[model samples]
Target: MKRRTFLGSVAAAGVGAAVAPGLLAPAVAQAATYKKRVTGADLDTNSRWQVAGTDLGIPYVLENGSIGYLFGDTFNSPWPEQQNNDWRSPVMLRSAVHPGEAGGIVFDSAAKVAGNGRAPEIMHNGHNGIGIDNLWEVTVIPNDGISFPETGRQLVSYMSIEHWNPGPRYSLWKSRYAGLAYTDNGNDFVRTNLKWFNDADNADPFQMWTMQRDGDWVYVFSVRSGRQDGPMMLRRVPWEQLFDPAAYQGWGWNGSNWGWGRPCSPILNGRFGEPSVRRLGDGTWVMAYLNCATGNIVTRRANTPDSAWNNEKIQVTFAQEPSLYGGFIHPWSGAGANELHLMVSKWTHGPAGNSTAYHVSQYVGSV
Candidate 1:
């Protein structure tokens, strides 16, 4: 496929812009609409989004005129005490977002049992007890289909079983399972015991990311983020049986037909960051994630949901930040031929000279 440089950065050596069907038309139109690259300004420059040392921001719009973001490794206190203490807590930040507001988010609740198992949270190792063995990261979405119960809350699903105790660094040790949860007022999210997905080993531990619901199925876009931060894995279950493990099936993309398979095959290539995916008005799927190699936000597009994706463009790079990690697309609303909104974050420990901190910041761009 023929291609040209996007501005000056996205060349063939960088982004893989294809000239296939449904790919070239968008590029020519985008060049005419946007200046060079699609970049968004910070919503508020006065104050950054404050929370415990956290990342993997999953943002969604609520029914009560507010925005909610579910995050992972979200601490209750400061560093060392943050991830080392209650490292597996999944927390939320809710706010009435405005353009020029100083501070962000109105209410930030304490960490609760967002993704713990049915058993007691305290795990007795014969002598001492531990409770940080449940969910560490999550991806929540609203039930957009008809005939669904109006819980005044959005339907939530998350990944867990991150064993952090009796270990060296407390890295996310093997994802356990994915389950369901829900909340309305933005805080007080309740997780259910029904685990709908899991893998026996770390070969392909699915880290649940962005979710989309069509007619009767809820399509989940996840990554094998543990053993190998590989391509995006797709899974779907009937809308009525989202919490039932037996109701789900990992899509087997075998070049020809997409069928059921365990430990779902990778759809894209290269070790990746935690990703967020959504369908555009033109039936193309757009996925945005932090490219670990470039320390920049990268994206890819696919003609079909379970097919080979093309045109991986490096969207934006945070040059001043350290540990500039992955990006998660704001799942509710943020996309166009020449513009999109995203929540990207970088990690921070203690001090910095003159750089961004450990807060999830928003960016809008035309990628």
Candidate 2:
């Protein structure tokens, strides 16, 4: 994902980069207010997704049934003729269990790239080969099966530009907020954004997790910002306090932030992203996420979501080919039985592009 390539395409297309309008319009804003309480029980895995227009990629499910996803679409918007190289990234949505119920907000990237260039651009721009588009947010209401509302309302939208030879080249663009939703809109929802690390010469992909370990409180686990040193940057925020505007900043832990106790192996050293956290019936929290290019799914456990985590282990390895990108884990019930399941996307070549699928594996007890 070179910065020059991304910005060059944007400039070449001559599309004006404009800031997003304020919140929802009056009519839609009024509609946005809901008296009905949307609960976790309203979300289900058995529900299917209808093809909401495949502009670039396929959509997959996030932990449990709270989120759905699509990625890698390559067509330019506002005008279909100007096609950039097919360098699409991940897109996700909030979903409901019942057929025609309303879910939460959706988030996605708006960038593309092709061919090789300079290592400088790649390092400086943080995976320069990939370009992100202005992030968009959508509200979903199921229509029978997988069919959803075709149009999505805009939340925070912005594009990234790469500093270049002439001036700042619009290399990478991003929306202010990634599409994430919470029920109360109080402390349950947290606001965060991506920032480029010029000193590290790479972009860190941040992952967010919300888990309930003991009582009713939810714990927020953020992978903070990642460098080459591995996914050691870990932070915990009380769920009830995260939504405060000022509390959202500086959540990363300070210190070594790596190592394993006697019972656990040394934590892998590298960047990590796409984290999924779930609580087992016995009251243990299990966290799983990808470690950089290795594409290995690693797990860690903690008695309380905010307590120090331990027992880091590799759950699955995709050494042969890295088909599993941006994955999530959840418990699924079917035919009177329930088991742990993983949903991942298979990157396709040629015209088909990409599609997501689910893999079911029994929960053999968490460490």
Candidate 3:
């Protein structure tokens, strides 16, 4: 899990980072043209998901056919004061709502929180000196989670942040490391030993990731810790070797050819934040993210996950909607069709007193 260890694994896999790229060209191409639209209003509000205000509404299919979402920095009450009452990060919510009825997604939800009706902070935030290493963690932000049909279990990736600096360097959230946590009951989770450390630069590529399982392998598309800028990279591990960091392989250009098992390389380049990728029911792969360059939620499609990612991007939001990030693909939206439904978040920060627009909206997009 350490950087050297990961590099060693890459070397042990028979691919060196110093290898020349003369065999093939990179997998980037001109963007394809696509379009989108807002299908409904915000999908989550203060009254729903025990989440008065939260972000990162990434959802994945559960074994029981329900949808499970991972939310970040939550405030269950009013703003400012909302931080005082039952605020927790990385909360999980379960919903039985069908993808077709995503506009009403909040109606069929319940958090892990019991009688209090608040969603439980499924992972430790390291506030009480209790974390994977017993150190007080600055924060815990959920990246993305996936449920494996082979094991009927789920694995979630998260960042154990160190601190967040104020403006001028707003986006640099110094992360302790990025680790994996697994759950069997969907409610309780246990952290695994697997982690990718953030060294001097605090820029680890696996910090933010979205995963999808195809055949025996789970493809991981990732970026660095800071959301401002970084190229998205790709890696894969056998479903059975999910926890074995050494078993993972990267897809990259060997200079003359685009192939698998090369040193990890960029498939898509941009000022990307949290991203979501999933294969549509029609067999197309779609990647959605907050484009910091344009300040909009955009998406791109490809025939295969490893194909040249240069497809026309579809803008998923409008100019009127600002201060928005997070474009999580709705699991049920691709069940039997390519109807794209996304869970988008909006958060505008100012001086402490203003009412910040912090909630998740459901949007419908197309290729």
Best by lDDT: 3
Whole-model lDDT, model 1: 0.46
The weakest ten consecutive residues by lDDT in model 1 span 1-10
Clashes of 3: 12
lDDT of each: 0.46, 0.29, 0.65
Estimate, for each residue in 1-367, the C-alpha lDDT of model 2 and write its tens digit. Answer: 2211111221122211111222111111000011121111122211122112122112222333333323222211211122342222222233334211233222221111112211011101112433333322211110000111211211111122233222222212222222233312211211134332222232333322233323423333433222122233233333344334333423232343422221111122334444556565666666655444344455666675534555345544454223433334442211112233333332323344322321111122123
Model 3 C-alpha lDDT per residue in residues 71-136, reported as the tens digit of each score: 877766543234355668788777786645524565355556554465678866775345768755
Q: Comparing 1 and 2 by TM-score, which wins?
A: 1
Candidate 1: which stretches are off by over 4 Å? 1-53, 63-66, 75-88, 96-153, 161-173, 184-186, 196-201, 227-231, 259-263, 280-284, 318-320, 332-334, 349-356
**Of models 1 and 3, which has the larger lDDT?**
3
After superposing candidate 2 on the true structure, give the runs of residues whose Cα lies further than 4 Å from its correct spot: 1-216, 224-232, 248-269, 306-312, 319-321, 331-338, 350-367
Candidate 2 vs. true structure, TM-score: 0.42
Task: In model 1, state the lDDT of residue 221.
Answer: 74
RMSD of every candidate to native, in Å, equals 9.9, 17.3, 7.9
